[model samples]
Target chain A: AAGVIQSPRHLIKEKRETATLKCYPIPRHDTVYWYQQGPGQDPQFLISFYEKMQSDKGSIPDRFSAQQFSDYHSELNMSSLELGDSALYFCASSPMGTRADTQYFGPGTRLTVL
Target chain B: DQQVKQNSPSLSVQEGRISILNCDYTNSMFDYFLWYKKYPAEGPTFLISISSIKDKNEDGRFTVFLNKSAKHLSLHIVPSQPGDSAVYFCAAVTSYGKLTFGQGTILTVHP
Candidate 1:
C-alpha cells in the first residue's frame, strides 16, 4: 500500500524566479522518477534517481536540476523558471533497478510559472 | 521520434459496452508495457501491465493484449462504466523502469 508523496500541491511563481518540488518515495523503494505533465498531455520523463545518485535525465533544460537525499527523498529545482515550465510535476517510485517494475505515483505538484 | 504512440485522441462508449483503447510502439526493444488511468487533476494510477513474453493479461474487467510481432498493445474494458471515464496512457519500458509514454486517449463512458 506504499505510495509516493509530493509536497507543495500547488505553486505559483513569476518568471525568473526559482521553484523547488519535493518527493518522498515509498520506504524500501530504490528508484525515484520525476515527470512533467502538460495540460491534456501525457507525462514526460524528466529525471530519475537511484541509490542517492542521479541515474538518468530526460531531455530537460539545464535550468532544471534534481537531488536525492539519504532517505530517498528527491528534490527537483528549477532556476530562472519560464512560463513553459508551468505544468504538473509528478513523482513516482519503483522497487530496485528494473524498468519493468510498476511505479506508484503521487498526487502531483501543479506549478504555474507566470 | 515518439517511441510510443496512441493514435486515438478520444473514444466514447455507452455504459455496459466494451471499450477498446489501442496503442502502438515503434521501439522493438521495449519488453514491458503498462496502462494507466488519470482523472482531471490527479496523477496517473496503474491499471494493468503485460510483459513481452505474454500475449495477454487480464484482471477483473480490464484486459491487456500485447502483440510483440506488430509492436502493438491494446486495453479492453468490458462493461465500461461512467466511473471508467478518464485519460488512459500507454507506457513502454525499454531500459529498466524508465518509461516512454504515449499521448493518452481520453475515454468517456456515457450512461
Candidate 2:
C-alpha cells in the first residue's frame, strides 16, 4: 500500500526566510491534514482540507498558508520564518467515506530555522 | 486545559510481559478513539481504535478498552517485544475528523 509522501525530509532555513513543504496523500484519499510537533511535544493540528476545500483550522499561524491542489496533494507555505517556527511538519490523509476519521501519516519534514 | 492527558510520561516492561497504557479525556461527546505509535524521526502509525458503541476492541496482541462513564481509555499490549519500544499517543475524535491527542507516553520493552 502506498503511504502519504512528504517532500524535503529535512530542511534548514535562516530567520526571515521562507519555505514550502509539499504532501502527496495516499491514492484515492480525499482529505489532507497538516500538523506540527515541536521538540518533545505532541503533534498539534494546524489545518485540514476536504475535497480541495478548507474544512477546519487549528493553531496555524497567520504567516502560514496551505492549499490542496486538484491532484489531491497539498502544500504548506511559511514566510517570515522565525526560530520558534522550527518543528516537524506532518501530513496525513484519509478517505472521506466511512473511514474518514482514520488518518494515515507521512514521514514528516523536519524544519530547522536558525 | 488539556482535553486528553497521559499521566505517566514513560513506562518500562520486560519482553513477553503485558504493557498497559492509560489515557483520560474530559470530553464526553467524543465518539471515537484511536491509538498511534511513533518511532523517532518518523510519523505516527495507526495502531488501533475503538468507537464509543463498543467497550473493547482487540487486534492481534493489542487491545483497546473504553470506559465512557469514567471518560477513560486504555491500550494493552500482550507478549511485548523489544521492537515495541516507541512513543504511544492516544487520541479522541468527534465525527468531524478533529482529533485531540494526548501528550504521548514512552514505552520501553527490554529484552
Candidate 3:
C-alpha cells in the first residue's frame, strides 16, 4: 500500500519569499487535498483538486496557488510568504469520487517562515 | 464559526480501561462523520467513521456512537493500550470532498 508522497518534508523561508511544495498522491487516486495545521490547532482545509480540475476551495490565502499536474501530482505555491503561514502542510488523496473524500494523508511538510 | 467542537483538550486513562471522547456538531446538513488519530509531527490517520443514517458503528475495539437528536458523537476505545495514545480529531462532511474539522482531544493511555 503506497501512501501519498510529499517533497521537502520541512521548509524554512523568510517573509516575502516564495516556496513551492509538491505532492504525489497514491496510485490510482484521483483526488488531492491540501490542509494547513497550525500549532495546537486542527487541520484547516486549503484547497482540493480532482483529476486535474479544481473541485473545491477553502480558506486558502490569495498569495497561495495550487494545481494538479497531468501525472496526478500536485504543487502548492506560496508567494510573499508571511510568518503566519508557518504550519504543517498536508496532502491527502482519495481513490475516486465514490469514496466521498475518505482521504489518505501524507506525512506532511512543515513550513517555518522566519 | 466552528461547526464541530471537541470541548475536552486532553484525557488520560490507564491501560485496560476504556477511553471515551466526546464531540458535538452544529451543522445539520452534515451526513458523515469521521475520526482521525494523529501523532506529534505526523499527519492524521483515519480511524473510524459513521454515517448519519446509523446511530452506532463499531470496529474492533473502537466504537462510535452518534446521537442525531443531541447533535453529539462519541468515540470509545475499550481496553485501552499505550499505543492508542494520540490526538483525536472529529471531522464532518456535508457534501463533496471537503471536510470541516474540530479541535482535537489528546488521549493518553498509560501502561
Top candidate by DockQ:
1
**lDDT tens string, model 3, B1-111?**
999999999999999999999999999999999999999878899999999999999999999999999999999999899999999999998867788999999999999
TM-score preference between candidates 1 and 3, better one: 3
lDDT (Cα) of model 3: 0.94
What's each prediction's clash count?
Answer: 3, 0, 0
lDDT of each: 0.91, 0.94, 0.94
DockQ-based ranking = 1, 3, 2
lDDT of 1 by residue, B46-94 (tens): 9999999999999999999998989999999998999999999999987
Q: After superposition, how far is residue A77 of candidate 2 from its true place, in Å?
A: 0.7
**DockQ of candidate 1 against the true complex:** 0.73
Residue B19 displacement in candidate 3 (angstroms) = 0.4
TM-score of chain B of each: 0.99, 0.98, 0.98
- The DockQ score of candidate 2 comes to 0.65
Q: Give the TM-score of candidate 2.
A: 0.97
Clashing pairs in 1: A98-B97, A99-B96, A99-B97
Could you tell me the lDDT of residue A38 within candidate 1?
Answer: 84
**lDDT tens per residue, model 1, A18-112:** 99999999999878999998876778999998998988889778999999999999999999999999999999998895454469899999999
